[model samples]
Each structure stands twice: as C-alpha cells, then as structure tokens.
Target: MDVRLLAASAAFALVSSITPGPNNLMLASSGLAFGFRRTLPLLLGVQAGFQCLLLAVAAGLGVVFQRHAEVQWALKLVGAAYLLYLAHGLWRSSSTGSAAMDRPIGFFKAAAFQVLNPKAWMMCLSAVGAYTLAGAAYWPSVWRLVALFFVLGLPSITLWAVFGSAFRAAFQNPETARRVGRALAVVTGASCLLVLL
Candidate 1:
C-alpha cells in the first residue's frame, strides 16, 4: 500500500465525515433534542453503516453505480425525498413537545438510513475509486482505506453531536429550543435541495 494514498484517503474521510450532511445534521439534532448519551447509538450506527457502505463500494458496488446512471438518479430522488420528510418531522417537533420529539433515532433505523444517504454513497464511491490501487494491492489498499475511515470518521462525527449537546444548556428554554430546531429543520431541508442539484 502506498503511504501517500493512505494519507490522502485519511484526509478525505476526515473532511467528508465531519462536514455537514444528512448524517451529521441529523446527529446534531438528535444530540440537541436527546443529549449525547442518547445520541451515541445513532452515532455508532452511522459508523457501522458507513463502513459497510465503503466495503460494498470497494467490492464492486461502485461499478454498478457507474454503469447505471438511472440508478444514481433514482437514489438521489429517493434521498432528497427522505431528507424532506425528515425536515418536516423536525419542523413539526419544533412547535410541539410531543412524544415524537422525545424519541431519538435508533441504531437499526440510523443504519438503514445510510442506504438512502446520497452523501454516503458519494463518499464511498469517491474513496474506493480514488484511493485504492489495482492488482494484488487492491484488497490491501481497500482494507487500509476502510480502517482509516472507521478510525477517523468516529471522532469527526462525534464532534458534531458534542457541539449540539453543548447547546443544551442554552436551549433549556422551550422557545429557544423551538427556534433552534426550526433553524436546523430549514438547514436540513436546504441540504435536500443540494442533493437534488
């Protein structure tokens, strides 16, 4: 395995995992609404799901996506729709102290959500295509990249959840929490537009 490629893949994984996307945004909302302890399962679920995705991409799933443009478009459509649905839920929870607002997304649900996350797909495809070498070194390089992502992604995403949790004190007031939740909802919705574009 090339050291340079490994380093590059590490950097890519860190940047992509830490950046605001559907996963991080949802995690932040979960942290703010439910606290970090409750959000830990969701965070772990994302890592599990993303590592699986990376493995799948490394194992030729990326080839299928590259060959099927319509499939890619369909995924984007579904992902955008799902994001919109989640944004609506967040928006609704902002106004009412309902049971739904008290519920944070669970491990299985969060893991399943990765299948519909366009950002996750893009990250996997790009990493597998750009970082891994061919021939005898292929599997080794792929494994290295996966390990790198797993190690780096966890803390990067944790930071988002932690950041949201930090605001819990400030958002102790119901009105303030509502406003922040609504803002997060708007941002989440806007991310859907980006996915579509």
Candidate 2:
C-alpha cells in the first residue's frame, strides 16, 4: 500500500469518527445521562463494531453490494429510515427537565447498530472504493487498509466519545439537556439524509 493512501485513510477515519453523527449524538446523551466513565463500554463497542465492519468490507463482502442493485437500495432505504427515527427522538426531547435520559445503550446494541448505520456503511464504502487498488494486488491492499484503519480508528473514535463527554457539562439543566438532545437527534437524522443525497 502507498503511504499517501494510508494517510488518506487515516484522515478519513478521523473525520468520520470524530464528526457529528448518530454514534456521537448517542455518546453525548450517554455521557450526559450516565457520565463519561459509564459510557466507555458503549464507545468501545462502537469502535469494535466499526472495525469489524471495515474488516468485512476489506474482505470483499461489502463489495457484493455493488453487484446487486437491490441490496444497495435496501441498505440506503433502511439507513434513511433509521436516521428518521433518530431524528424524531431528538425533535421530541423535553427541553425543561433535569438531564433525565435512558441508561446508556448496551454494548451489543451499539455494535449491532453499526451494521445498520448508513453513515458507517458509507464510510466503509468510501474507504474501500478510494483506497484499495485494482488487479492482482487487490487482496493484499485490502488487508493493509483494514489494518491501517484498525490502528488509526480506535483513537479517532475515542476522541469523539471524549468530545461527547466534554459536552455533558452543557446538560446541567434538565430543560437545556432535553433541548440539546432533541437538536442532536435532528442532526443525526440530517446526516443520514446527507448520505442519501
């Protein structure tokens, strides 16, 4: 694998992991509700799930979607629907209560969501499409790319969770917390739309 391509993959992972998305929004909510320490499992689960997904994509399973138009559309449709669901949750959050929120999502659920998340899938697709070379060396390149992502990905995701933890301070007021939660949910939904469009 080329050094430049490796750098690009790292950069992409950093941006995708750190940016506002369903995962980060949930992390922020978890942080505000349960404290950063409690949310660690959730964060770790996300990283693990994404790494697995990347591995699958690298192994060519993700490429199968390219051959089947129906599968591609199904993924997009499901992804769009999930984002809308998240948006509704946000738009409906209460604005005037103590930062009362559900307990943080468990590791299993968070990991599973990664499989369904459009944003995650898109990131994997973009990485595979852009970085992996063609022809006889493709498999080797894919393996290197996956390894690189695992190395670069964990820290990048951790940073986003930390950012979410830091934002917990803004949730001191119940009403404020509720309002912020709703806004975050909306952003999550919007991100899904952005992927589709």
Candidate 3:
C-alpha cells in the first residue's frame, strides 16, 4: 500500500473508533459502573473481536453478506434484541443500585458482541472495500489496512474508557451516578434503531 493510503486507513480507523457508537458508549457505561480497571476486559475484547471481523472481511465474507438480504435481516433482529436487553439491564442497574452492575461484561461476551454490532460489521466491510486496492495484489493492501486499523483504534477506543472513568469524579453522588446510568441506558437503547436505518 502507498504511504498515503496507509495514512488514510489509520485516520479512518481512529475516527470510526472515537466516534460515539454502541461499543464506545458501552465502554463508557461499563467504566462508570465498574471503574476503568474492571472495564478493561470489555475494551480488549472489542479490539480482539474487531480484528477477527476485519480478517473475515479481508477473506471475503463481506461478499456473502452483500448477497444475502435475509441473513442481514436476521442479524439485525438479533442485534436489536441484544441492544435492548443491555439497555434494560443498565436501566435496572441504575434503579436498583445493585452490585450486579459492577460485574463488567465478560471477555467472551464482549467479543461475541461485535458480531451483533451493526456498526462493527459496517466498519469491517467498509474498510475492506474502501481501503484495499483491487486486483490480485489486494491481499497486501488488506493486511496493511487491518494492521493500521488495529494500531489506531486502540487509543481511540481507550479515550472513551478514560472519559467514563473521569466521570466517576463528577458523579460522586449515588443519585448523580444513577442519573448518568439512566442517560446511558437511553443512548444504548436508542442504538437499536440503527439496525433499521
């Protein structure tokens, strides 16, 4: 890949990772509930899952998605359901003030979550489609783009976790934390609509 193309891939990766999305929002929510140290697994798991998705797309799985409308519909339904469930969980956690919320989502669970995250799918597909140069030589370009994304996405995503932890101080009061949690719930739940869009 040309140096310019590599730079563009890095820029796109950072922007996509930094933008407010289900994963970043959830990371922030988890950090607020469990603290940054505790939410680390979710952060790492998301990166791991993302890399796998990127690899799959590079290997041409995205074309299968392009051909199968029903598959996309089914995935959208499942993803929407999962997002709604998480929203409800966050809502209940806020209302109940239970320690259960302190248990951050596990590594495997977070990794599994990437498949259901429509944004993740779109990112992987778009990266492969847009960043990789066409022709038989595209494999090298795919690897380069994936590598750049992995390198750039880490700090981009970490900022959300750090920001959430910073909110810990601002939300020192139980009531304030509760309010933040409820607000997060609304954002998280609303992400479900992205499936339709």
Candidate number with greatest TM-score: 1
Off by over 4 Å in 3: 99-102
Q: Against the correct fold, how does model 2 do in TM-score? A: 0.82
What TM-score does model 1 achieve against the real structure? 0.95
- Looking at candidate 1, the ten consecutive residues that score lowest on lDDT are 93-102
**Which candidate would rank higher by lDDT, 2 or 3?**
3
Error at 189, model 1, angstroms:
0.2
Give the Å shift of residue 172 in candidate 1.
Answer: 2.3
Question: CA lDDT of 16 in candidate 2?
Answer: 72
* Better candidate by lDDT, 1 or 2: 1
lDDT of 3: 0.84
List, residue by residue over 1-197, the lDDT tens digit for candidate 1. 56787788899999999999999998898888788999999999998998888898888888999899999899999999988888888888778843225588889888888888999999999998898888998988888888888889999999999998999887778788788878988999999988987
Clashes of 1: 0
How well does candidate 2 score on lDDT at residue 143?
A: 79
Question: Considering every candidate listed, which one attains the maximal lDDT?
Answer: 1
